[model samples]
Target: MTRLWNAPDDFPDEMLAGFVAASGRWIRQVPGGVVRSTRDPRPTVSVVIGGGSGHYPAFGGLVGPGLAHGAAVGNPFSSPSARQVESVARAAHQGRGVLLSYGNYAGDVLHFSEAEAALRADGIDCRTVRVTDDIFSAPADRADQRRGIAGDFTVFRIAGAAAAAGLGLDAVESLASRANARTRSMGVAFSGCNLPGVDEPLFTVPDGRMAIGLGIHGEPGIAEVDLPTADGLAQLLVERLLADEEVPLPDGPSSARVVALLNGLGSVKYEELYVVYRRVAELLDVAGVVVADPHVGEYCTSFDMAGVSLTLLWLDDELERLWFTPADTPAFRTGSVRTSLPRPAAAASTERPDGPLPRASAESRQLAARIVTALDAGHAAIDAAAEELGRIDAVAGDGDHGVGMRRGTRAASHAAAAVAQRGAGASTTLNAAADAWSDKAGGTSGAIWGVILRAVGRELGDEADPTAEDLVRGLNRAVEGVTSYGKATVGDKTLVDALVPLADTFAAAVGAGADPALAWSKAAAAATRAAAATADLLPRMGRARTHGERSQGTPDPGAVSLAVLARVVEQSLSPVD
Candidate 1:
């Protein structure tokens, strides 16, 4: 590395200690690897953001107008000292109140709390905001335990700008909380990062796999899985972000869409970052997840580590307007983005659905019962997987896919059980039974369930002993319907990736003179393989693509669930000789 002192003649002030020192007074540091200061906070508002040393653009580089008024740098992966935090608070408070912000971490909390106390003792009116934007870090109810990650920059930028605009401490505090609520983040670490001055990385995970919840400093994760290509990773992030939405106040997604940021750690190239951002923006755009203000760059980092984090901030009207408000800064700059939050719509009919109609046979109803039983048998795994997936989707797609699927499957089973009691026909019974699924499921699953059962009803139209030939026809139509209804194809990282291929295989076996049992077996087997194959594809179309390469290897739960359904259907179709 070139020596800064000996660099040729006139180097940029950014690299000079005099410039750094003159920019602000030496405020103290805070918790979670953050530093703080009040000293000469530029333009109007005082801001704070800090982390460890190596991630340059982070703790120190963000200090400028419209950014941090002060930073509280921690000791590498540790928290900043209390004195450091106190200095920041003292510097930031200029009688107009001071705004303190940083990523959520234990050390940061400890130090910042001390700083808050010290500030009040010194008669300075200071308020601190914690960044807890990562949806994957903890359950929403337990978000206080989550690590803030990169989305902290958005919260700081917006809130800091507002404070500069002369909003009092209350307004700043409210804006900060609202932005934090609107924001969610998730990240995948391919390789562990080294702690400065250490001989080795903090920990290690196998190459070509992702550490799903690896802390910025190499904490253990919810799970570790094979690495994905870039598109797959992007989709994973996007899916989690959308899933984290609060059901959009009973209105559609347009009202729910908000400002989004695609942040890269220090090591990720801008080239790769933009590639991820473009695909994610398109996915969000298609899904109606708004992009009022879109930021794509390295706003945070883990010391040149080869990984990235995804963050979404759900904007209310005030947040949207504030996020776009003009304020110059060395790191963040933006214009206005129109954000809307729709009023909650009154719910539709609440009556228990009409009793299952006639037409669904005892056998088919039995099939539904069996599927439900299988799900029930694996309830723990289902719930766990759903929880994990829900966390994942919270980063990228509509957040409720897990809960939605769980609800849909359980409701379908319940409806079948109810219909069985009433002796409803296979077609009518299943149709009415599916009403619960349609009403209960949300997002893509809701639409998929509607098509799936409609095809079943079509084949069973008032028939006695509808043969496997009838089943084949229904399956074929179902595949076509899924393709048509979703407008997503096999490689788009969708359930169709498994469903279409399975249906085709089943139809081919039947056409080649195989018996119903044999054909069904072939299709079920094909579906299992196809579902696994999806891990190899990127989420080119949906929330999965935003996860990019990080999504590879983890089979999509929807596709896997579909395969399971095929297996159940095939077994049900077989009869004793």
Candidate 2:
């Protein structure tokens, strides 16, 4: 439960509700999504925005002097009626015209499209700028068929700026179309959310897993992978969005600039949102995408849901300048958009050897392979454990640890497979795999897994010859990294519980002059034992803590997954027997 207020379940329609009474948070029941504006203005260039009610400032916040002239409020996931759309449009039009902006959804299409007709009939000059983001929803060519997730902000700024510039409705609408062409979005939901007045969610994508391209209203998605970390998740969304075989870079002064927005559906704090924003900005910088104007915090939302979405608007010379041209609205305040374009990442020179970091011997390769396979086998068990953990987390926390773990695992496995097939050096291979995991998988698990692989790789460096001692040292270092960054210990019911035991077992086996294969086997056994022992231990942190006693009987999902990883190493040791 968030420290917030909600309208009573049975409140009458059109009643001032949802907001705390007299808190001036501003609440009123408008039909469907068509909430009339309370602002004092017989405005010009009215901002008529709507979607489902939960998106917040998306449809409402952008309604102000430098933003929307008026807005139509809708029920959550439900579009305002044509009448409501036209009404808001009428309220916003000054003699010039109305600018219609909303996420791309079926209901929105029907309602807003209908509103266009109604406005034309009423002699109101109204135009629409639909935001079709969520690249994962469809192929880029087919994005029009997909529902908009978070790209509405870009459309708002572009078209809104044009309106602010006193451009005719035609030019403003054209700018919106260009923004729609350039913008893209994707989102992940670990758990489902409930609609206001409804006891249950409309749908669910499952617990401990993420539905890529998942609809804002709990609809199905492109794929279901376990959850990843904030940075990892940010990467997943960005990569999938830019996964066009290649994104054509704009020419400098020529190259394009970008405005980034990290939208928390709800429940996440602004502080955490900025953390994500910084990561995305860093990645964009790497891609040569300059940040012209970055907007964070909750511009759009899903009514207390725990997930977040990213929106990017690629800007050119014309669009970039218009971004900051003042417009009035309740949600967005105009700010400086003047900035330089980002340069492409520096290219590698031919001077140094850039071959695969360092290859491992056949024996070491076998060890790595077995560890990878074992991790794969435990996928089923990991899923079950994650689901249970998520349920527990939902009671108190955001209920996404399980999902994050699952996503990270899937990505890690895929990355490992690609690396092994390529005959890359051990450390280099691990780094590559970790990057893949962090990119495909999202959330905390991916982040931790990436850290673990990198730490181990750093120890291994480029090595053609290695002793058991060397391997043992690397394992120990990896464990240290996990423990250090994850801030968890053996009894915390995290993967460390199993990995810690594995590290100890590896050191003992290597000391006893055991074969690398046998050492890993022993490590696997120890990991399994430690993971099992977790069933009786209390979960002291993260989502597991929310269930209290309920979590006591289930093994930690993280621990089990770690055990699986150990087995993969053990299995890799066996010959083609």
Candidate 3:
């Protein structure tokens, strides 16, 4: 249990603050995360790596002389926002190009891709390599879909080494991709982890049983069996890894050489790990594999999870050489590092003069006030249903949907209220809310809501009051944006499943001469029905796709949240009797 915290929501920020204060020798505080306090003597490709904040050494602890140049940390079990990633990359860039690497989760991919686009727009040469090395997440035929686990260390180390060697962005990316291709990892959990203030663990295993093929983000394992002894467990791990012939062994003279890591997820102590690794070593030797630079400790972890994982990096000449490169960081360290001068402090920003608001019609300002009321209602609705939503999502997903939705809606409501109080128009208020929701929430739901609100805001300009036709048009644009950006369709068991029906129904009602309030009410009802019908769907997108059968009896959490918000907004719009 996570007992020490000011507030559950403040845990990530508080943890990061203490980390920077204690580790000032290696890292410095930045807008999104920490960056290396010292600089290399010469320019090199910046290796920026990150993900959600629960994994300690994985992100912040790895920022140092020969490892990651910076890390973009996010909320617990949530990917960093695009704005966050962009800020860290900008701070870490040293005239040379940047390489962004992280686990291959859906939210991480979306935000990182957005940051990559933004960096390119600013003329910064940036590239991305997603780590997909968890063997059990997907079959060999769909290796690209696997989640990244402890194998992230192999990929990050190689990328950082290539960069420190003064390789160009192209070469660095190639080496990181190669590292990911050669690495394989599998994890088992004896128990689940608890979030900061949550009363229970995300999942649990029966006594004397163990879960296999678990994920780091509080997801339960795919299969469970009776627990085995230390030696038997080592054999199970080794045999499973050796059975995967699809990831062929290293070629040439190094065909039998490999780098093995026995990683503790979180609560498993060092002594127990040593016991397991003892037998793991014997099995590898018997199988004719020569281990090089074997590591046995925590590398990547779930917060306080009782689990361990085994990672094997099949090595060739170049990889083996890179693996032995010296590194100095707060967590992992190797051979001695060369002395380097401290980086110069960043220039302080001067406060800019405030500007007057753009003129807007009184009618538009009146509608903006209503928009704020609707946002408040949406926040209330999500807050009330958050626990239930989390329960539904935990069936197959990471179980953070409810928490994310609550955060987004709360931010959106506050932003909308502040902008509306300043006499802002409907468009400006919605746009402010959209940006706040996305920035604070930081996940797939955040990104999708940002798109939905922004698309609608564009159609509700400040010049005039919006009509039923305008509302329908804005909703249509939102639907188009979501489908295009998220690549999800009606039956994919996502928010799009409910969003599509709601938009189509509203558009039809408005076209038939119904008022905006009536159209919205009808649409909200349709969305509710659509959300409930998702219980029968097999999820074909996002993390749920990996455990599709597990989600069969639960409606999609995204769809349910969308419907709940729509109903609340509709109530705010309808005229009281």
Candidate 4:
């Protein structure tokens, strides 16, 4: 259990602060995470790695001279906002280029993709490599869908080593890619992890039982079984990994050379890991495979989860050579590095200015005021339902949905209030709200909502009071924006299910000459219905996809939240009784 926390939501920030203060010798504080306190004598490709914050020594702890150049830490079990990623990348980039690496997860993918585009737009020459090494997460044929576990160390180290060697962007990317492909990992959990200030663990396991093939984010394992002995557990893990044909053992098992890493998730103490690794090493030796730099300890974690994971990085001559390169970081270090380079100076300011407010007509300004009222009502609704949202999300996804939504709506309201105070139009107001919501929330829903609001804002220009036709066009744009970026369809059990019906019904009603208020009310009803009907859907996207059956009998938290916002907005549009 996480016993010492000032506030649940503030834990990530507090953790980062303490980390920087303690590890000042090797790292300096950055906006998102940390960077090396020292720089290389010459320019080199920057290898930026990140993910959710619960996993220590993985993301932030790995940022230093020869590992990650920087890390974009996110909310617990959530991806960093695109703004955070962009800031870290901008600060870390040298004259050469930047390479972003992280575990394969939906929120991480969405936000990282957005940051990559933004960086490229600024001509920063950015690239990404998502580590997918958990063999148990997906079938061999669908290895691309697998989750990244402790294998992250191998890929990050190889990429960092290549970059430190002054390799070009192409070579750095290739090395990371090859390392990822050559790596495979699997883990088992004896218990679930507790989120800060949360009473219950994300998921629970039966006493005296262990879950096999569990994910790092407290996701339930693929299978459950009675607890086994250390030697028995070692045998199970090694056999599964050895037989996983996804790992190309071209020279057969006996002649294969590999780097073995036995990682304790969190609560599993160092002594326990050594016992497990002892059997693991004995088994490998008997199998005649050469183990290179066999690492046994905590490399990644899940907020005090009682678990351990093993990763094997098959090595060729090049990989073996690269693996021996020196690194210096808060958590992991190898060979010595030049210490003459000075730490980077702190950023002057991270606050982005609100550009000049666009001019608006008197009627549009009044509408913007109303929009602010609607946002206030919506925010209130989310705040009220935050606990329920989290409950629904914990059924199949991480239980942070409610907390994330609450933060997003609060930020949105503040942004909208400020913009409306300046007499901005609907477009500017909504655009500002979108930015704030996404920036504060920093998750899959945050990214999707950002796209939705920005699309709507684009159609409702600052110059005029939006017509029914304009509203419909904006709805269409929002739907397209969400579906395109999120890659979720109507029945994917996401917000799109409610949003599509809401947009279609509203458009149809408007085309039939109903007023905007009536059309929106009817559309809100349709959305509510669609959202409720999602109780029977099996999620095909996002975190829930891995545990589709676990979500049955519950509406998607994203869909339900959207419906809630829609209903609140419609009520605000209606005439007061």
Every model's Cα RMSD, please?
20.7, 21.8, 2.2, 1.9
Predicted structure 4: clash tally: 1
The C-alpha local distance difference test score for the whole of candidate 4 amounts to: 0.87
Q: For residues 182-239, could you state the per-residue lDDT of candidate 4 as single tens digits?
A: 9999999998888887788877889989989888887878788999999989999999
Clashing pairs in 3: none
lDDT of 3 by residue, 277-296 (tens): 99999999888888987999
TM-score of each: 0.52, 0.53, 0.96, 0.97
lDDT of 2 by residue, 401-455 (tens): 4554555566566666666666655566667666645433333455566667777
Question: In model 4, which runs have C-alpha deviations exceeding 4 angstroms?
Answer: 346-350, 573-577
Residue 266 C-alpha lDDT in model 1: 58
lDDT of 1 by residue, 70-138 (tens): 665543344444545565545444567667787776445645665677677767677788998777767
Candidate 3 global lDDT: 0.88
TM-score of 1: 0.52
TM-score of the candidate numbered 3? Answer: 0.96
- Runs of candidate 1 with Cα error greater than 4 angstroms are 1-45, 245-252, 334-577
At residue 402, candidate 2 shows an lDDT of 54
